[model samples]
Target: MPPPEPGDVINYIYLFAHEAAAGRDEGVKERPVLVIASDAMGVAVVPITTKGEARSSRSDRIPDPVARAMGLPRAGESHVVVNDVNDFDWRGHDVIDLKTGSFLYGRCPPTYFQKIVRAVQASAALITDRR
Candidate 1:
């Protein structure tokens, strides 16, 4: 499969801040992440979780329509935690394959991606740099 581009939603083992602070080197489980940026250096992604409330300042809710478009399950709402982004090499070891011949769940629409970018920029989210 080709390298993931910005706007792609892919399953990843995203190590959270608390986990890292506790000396845990890995995430607890695989979860979806939004590929906010990708370049020669690596990719920057924000974790998508079902944990945030709507209109939360630290997170941007993924609309049901958009989530469906991205092939996410219809189980519940997902939010992009804009305040915590993870940076790592493209196709890094933390990436997980969903047994679909690719790591990608699907791509977010351009407009929605732009909205996410705006939200991230507006927040004081910490960008955790990792290999």
Candidate 2:
């Protein structure tokens, strides 16, 4: 049970985001979202403080990091499917973002869905060592 490598932890940002977007738009496979890599790019620094770490940052902070890190546009502006890229999709757990509730991604009371999404995300790690 070693700690997740930087890349695995890094992708968690997208995993949560993709989960949120999926719930927001259940019918669509692609959904744009924002991210923040803790401004550690180019410095050769593996910051352990990405937005996904504390889940305290505002969801609005997403685009800045994604744009800076992956050259991706802000969420809602461009379309990216969670499964299409290296991102996660329908991992079985429903996703819930309390912070984004009714503010950025347009939702609420994430407690209900949070556990579901978490379970799904957790189950996703079953077959692959991606977790």
User: CA RMSD for every model?
Assistant: 2.5, 15.5
Worst 10 residues of 2 by lDDT: 36-45
Put down candidate 1 lDDT per residue, 1-131, tens digits, no spaces: 34588999999999776566679888888899899888876899988888784233378778888988887864257888887788898668999889887788998999999999998888877777778
Off by over 4 Å in 1: 53-57
Q: Write the per-residue lDDT of candidate 2 for residues 16-118, one digit (tens) a residue.
A: 3333444632312222232211122210001122233223221212334343343332432322221112222323121232333411232212342243234
What is the total number of backbone clashes in candidate 1? Answer: 0
lDDT agreement of model 1 with the native: 0.82
Report the Cα lDDT for candidate 2.
Answer: 0.26
Q: What is the TM-score of each candidate against the true structure?
A: 0.88, 0.19
Q: Rate the local accuracy (lDDT) of all candidates.
A: 0.82, 0.26
